[model samples]
Target: MKRYQAVRGGTGDLTKPDVNTRVQDNLYLAVNSKWQKDAVIPADRTEIGVNTAIDMRIEKRMMSDLDKMVSDNKVPAIKNLDKAVTLYKIAKDFAKRNKDGAAPIQADLKKLDALKDFAALNQDANELDEVYGLPFGFEVEADMKNTKVHVLEFAGPGTFLPDTTSYKQEDASKLLAILQKQTVKLLTMAGMSEEKAEKYVAAGLKFDQKLAKVVKSTEEWSDYPATYNPYSLSDFLAKIKSFAMRDFLKELLPALPDKVIVMEPRFLDHFEKLINPDNFDEIKGWMVIKFINGLSSSLSQEFREAGFPFSQALSGQGELIPQERHAYYVANGVFDEVLGIYYGKKYFGEEAKADVTDMIKKMINVYEDRIQNNDWLSENTKKKAIVKLRALVLKIGYPEKEKKIYDLLQVDPAKSLYENEKALSKITTKYAIDKLTKPVDRSVWLMPGNMNNACYDPQRNDITFPAGILQAPFYDLHQSRGQNYGGIGATIAHEISHAFDNNGAKFDEFGNMKNWWTDADFKEFNKRTQAAIDIYDGLSYGPSKLNGKQVVAENIADLGGLTCAIQANKVDKGSMKELFENYARSWAQKQRPEAIKTEIAVDVHAPQPTRVNIPSQCQDEFYETFDVKPSDGMWLDPEKRVRIW
Candidate 1:
């Protein structure tokens, strides 16, 4: 111990192993030690061995039970098929009862025939292949029939409670009749013949009736609750706290959390001076605005360089852009360049230009009204909201100009794919460098005008509906206002609700990062939001579980959008039940398991089943429309249900 030793490089006694030798020796010792440890343990050890044995025995018992059930059944793989048959039978009966005209029913019959063919094909597949290869085949075939049933249920007499007195069951029928009459009146007012109006009404009635039958059939297979589970309350509260805590922590820690970070010092400097010091708690607020500006510029450059036709990129192609950044560009005038290209003399000709301008003006009016009338917002915030709404410069159809960013990079059609990629990289880098010194340009479009989606920008506090989404299923001049509102109106409501969602709530009407809520008001808002979190957390879907905390913001938007759309329809004297049903129908979809798994991890929106079922539980209109009872599968406890507007 008294002897001096050099720890870094000097060797010790010859009896000891060297560093590398010692490492090898230690590894060997570890292997031998593990073996000895295992050898010392008895095979019959009660603690670990008994538990595993018990688990295996229980699993065996369950498997045996399942095997018995499968063997006893004549059609072991036919549960979905049986459900489809039952739905088809219900549709046939409904058709018979409402046989004013048979065209729609005949169409349903054709669908049933197709289902039968698919089922037969499934039956012929081997058990091994069926189990592993075709698990989704049955569901895919059944969904076709289910969708039809869903549509039918919306149009018919609807449902009634056998014992309770709420609204008259006949009121729904009376409403439908009135709707038919008014539709005819409106058509006649728009200049259709009496005979043509009658024919149109007949066709419309038939379509609604069939649609209701389809809806009912689909609903039959759904796992909606008859009543809210009291046991779920504890779980719901826990979930709300977890989600809120996580998001709150995320927001507080970074102070400037966003998808992309742009480190442009000049813009950051300008932003810092522009924002009032009292408004921002930290310097990070300025960082966010500058980053967003850079992001918008980057996206605009990318779109411009792609050299794709304007309509193909913006409207028809359905290309997904980074949503957060795209929202910012749409709010600013940055989208004008692309719009000019498509709306000019070369595209759509000049006749449609005036119509396009009128549509844009109407859209702006709707945005302005929404911003001004939001009750939860304070007056100071409302003025800012109004300013932002007014400042949203409209860019209809296509941009009025184009950028030459792509000219920096030459693309040869004959070049190899790798060569083209290198050229693109160079172009992107050059474009980014070019933006470093330029003043922020608001007249750029992040997405093409022809795109089929819409968005709300928290920074700019503006909303945009691209030209692509302006077509069928969203907007159709030939369709009734009820249909158009249910389709496009719901979409508008969805975008507007985003303005108040968790992240969006941080931005003021002027697109500045700030808290505009009073302490009391913020507390109240959190309490209500927590209630929703708890409700959604208890939900189960198939084999996977829902991440309640992750989906709270989007869920809030969904519920709010539905509520807003229903209110809007009521103001227009439209059927509230129809509006609710249509909202549900818009979300009717199917997906592969792999795709669903990916969505769960990355997508902010909840899974399809939860999207449809959870929001419906919050709406009194839905409960009344569908005759849902406290004992029904989809009921929510009165005290536990959350409503925030």
Candidate 2:
């Protein structure tokens, strides 16, 4: 306690804390008030936290390494690191890029202009994405029913706004105006007159509005069952009358399968309606906007500046990120594994990997025990749960089968950044297409080690802990087990619990979308899930409230994760105070009020303050540890508190 106090800037007013401020009552504020008081969210950022801080640190290191790779002639010495350096060097040439203006994408724009009909558009879709990238996406993901094979999937076009619900906002007119102004500016820079640009913006706005009606909102899509509709090619064609589904797939698919997954059937239905000859002008306008927005960072200073205000309005960022930093991020996106391998080799040591791996094993053990002891589930259900838990794949630190996607990458420093990115996109597309014929590789990892986030892929039944997230605030080799358990332990548990969350629970041990639970057991599960939803639905941050129905799966995972971690701590012989305090400290964050509003509306995860306080308040152990009573601001009624694992 003394050590924690000393490290956290000594004790301050524990006895005479502000009651009205609600700081005394909240565990998060009590643990992190000293740091929170001084924390500042960067002007270019929406929010700032331990995660972001660590990412910035890693970015600086990557930038330095890139500089060395380019200037110090270290590229040839390393095996795969040169590809990242090559991409970085090409993008880093700001002067040449600014001078080139929109010339690099001019040929691509000409191709779009020459598209005479829908047939031409279909034929060019794959090629066009390689140049400007597509808002409409296609993928071959693991089949939900038959998990052994990859299935062709079609999804709706990506929105310019943060989410589909943004189109229906009461203040939507204001957002539309911002989009109009930005679109006009971008088109004008792309050689269109201001008058003509306004016309395009009008068409684009109407097109998106029509599409928004049928497109699923982020909240709606979170329901796995809602997006799981499947159809045969003939059946899919019959559902829509406006377009030839078979003809469209001729160019898009190498060999059209009899069966295809319709992720958003409503969107596809409306998209067919929206794709007539009369709508080409509107489609062209939307395509132009997407093209310009996608490559804005790699364009001239004017083009980049033109897109900033709209981005700022969307995300509530005060200023655009620095050009060098922006280029670094672009390199990371294009050459993910190249940078990941370098990052892991440089920053993540063997000791850290070993420690994290051991921690993961412990958490998995705890979850198996949890499932075995759970009273609500039937014996058969529990046995199936244990089977799935045991089969859970763990990928800690980095991938064992090295990702060598950069072998074909060739970037010339003298070429424009847009040209280099376009070239890389073609190679990436080819790589994705190559996977269509291959068997499902269970060892494949979805996330890069350089990313400061963890993920659980229900289809793969796997959890990934990237090297970037394996450090500080989350884990420390020298720190006490209590602190480590509270930091990374909760994160590990959260992801594991995701396997049992609303969406993930649909998939069984073999990663097939088969229910392992009995009808009665599933009914009980729904009741508990509904209770959780009701609790989160009522939570408010100032005037803004949470859409608990949208974020229930994540919230359930959060509670389950924290509970599992706390239980694991009990087994590991750790202090509750240390574990609980560190848990609060891990979620310590601050954001702009505007950012808070955006997050509450669009983000699947709860706001930082909500994340820290809500989980602790719901736990009985939290109350016991802190001696919290009904009179305290953070206290909840015993029956109101919801729990599920």
Candidate 3:
């Protein structure tokens, strides 16, 4: 049997490589592969490609469920509509009580009405389908079933071709030009003499060159490192204290009446702690440089306050629910039910408990082993990697402690939607302000626990997996291990890889922004990355082209994680062919046209099919598993395959 099974069934002999092949062949034969394949190919009359099948089904299912809810319960058109209206009423009442003037509150009421109208328009699922180009469901169904086979094929053994692109050189030049132009403009706006503006721009460019040099000298940082011990609480406190002080001044210095105060809080907060500030003079100089670089004024307060300590709330918070209950809710979406049967227990039972533990353990072990065995990284860097790896703290389920600010705000049962929005905004801003002057709180999770996603925070050097993503199709106890590992395990690898991607590499083991690579190493890293980007850029999706520069960081992580997961499977004696297929299946999803448009505009990840096809091209294993020749649709020239990590 494959090391990872999708559904619990009979185990296969682990001793033979052909065991996976036999399993896949039998599974394909059992399902009548030819018929399944034919079902996915849409008729000429259909608008969407067969590739869109699963997305369409998900959309249809959601729409049907929503319709039933509205009909049976007469639910509001929008989720939480009643709550929004009530908040607006309360804001208005509060305004009246305080005699602080009701004009602003009345204006908010108008916005609510607009929001309600928008919500009403969106209530029709068919309308949503029209707005978002929907992928066909048949396509997804056809692909998802055979994911294990495809993933293994995708990551099979092969040498990676060295990429020789100088794409970063071009990008660096463009960035330099923009900075030069912006610097001059800012100097002129601040009423500097023409000669001084020119000098300032020249000086800024020179400084940028220095900064780039520092970055270039630290290429080894690009390699993934093992986990480390958590930074001491005292160390975290000291760092935040210094960062807060520097951030505050970065905001205050340029606020003088005669000078242009271009320093925005967001930019300042982002860069203030990132740059070293050992001496007061050096710190002031950095602030001046930022002011000349066109920082906005509106972000000052936000930057200063963002340093708030929230981690203190994490400890001593008693468990919200039993472990079994938490696991059951994650897997089956039932509070105390098994399959269809109800249980007297408050949460999940024994079955769920075992599943969650097993999955988490597998993911962590894979990551630890990969970091230890990585060949591209230096031994010194490996030690630091281990520190970061060991320091990783996983937060599952919901936040142990919820922010208490929401309770202070008043809500009325009746009011317009706009008023409620304003009240909510006020509450959020108040919470932001409350964070100022606090100690660095490591426990504050950037994403809520239930969000259907995972992320790696370079600031804290931690990877997070939310509860919302730990369910069926992604991870399920009932599914075979091959399916679960290929699905959720791939995602876990992706997030772990992010810690070593381009931008994340800027931080050191202690999560401080520091350079720790040799110059020669940095050059090789950039050369390799640019090559990867070029390959991705060549990929076409209809009329649009992939933004190689913008997507380079994420693409690197995708490739690395895919690479690591495949390698881990091999170490465990799993079939490489099954792993590749399962990897592809993990990304199997359909999309609405509206959603596709939105994704193209802002999403960092490639669209579903491209996510599978493009990466597969770089993996030699994929071609071998599918018996793909040079003429195959997904084939790339052997020389063109870029291997960065």
Choose the strongest candidate by TM-score. 2
**Candidate 2, which segments miss by more than 4 Å at Cα?**
1-24, 76-78, 114-135, 240-244
> Per-residue lDDT for 348-405 in model 3, tens only?
3456545655555666666667667766767666666666666666655444454444
Summing lDDT over every window of 10 consecutive residues in candidate 2, give the lowest-scoring window: 1-10
* Per-residue alpha-carbon lDDT of candidate 2 for residues 94-147, written as tens digits (9 for 90 to 100): 788788888887887677656676556656656655665544566787788877
TM-score of each candidate structure, all chains considered together: 0.44, 0.93, 0.51
lDDT computed for candidate 3: 0.42
The CA lDDT at 323 in model 2 is: 78
- Give candidate 3 misplaced runs (Cα > 4 Å): 1-361, 571-575, 591-598, 637-639
lDDT of 1 by residue, 7-118 (tens): 2111122112233322111211111222222322222221112122333333243234333444564223311222222222222232232332222223322322232232
State the displacement of the C-alpha of residue 250, model 3, in Å, after optimal TM-score superposition: 14
In angstroms, how far off is 217's CA in candidate 2?
0.3
Compared with the true structure, all predictions reach lDDT values of 0.40, 0.77, 0.42
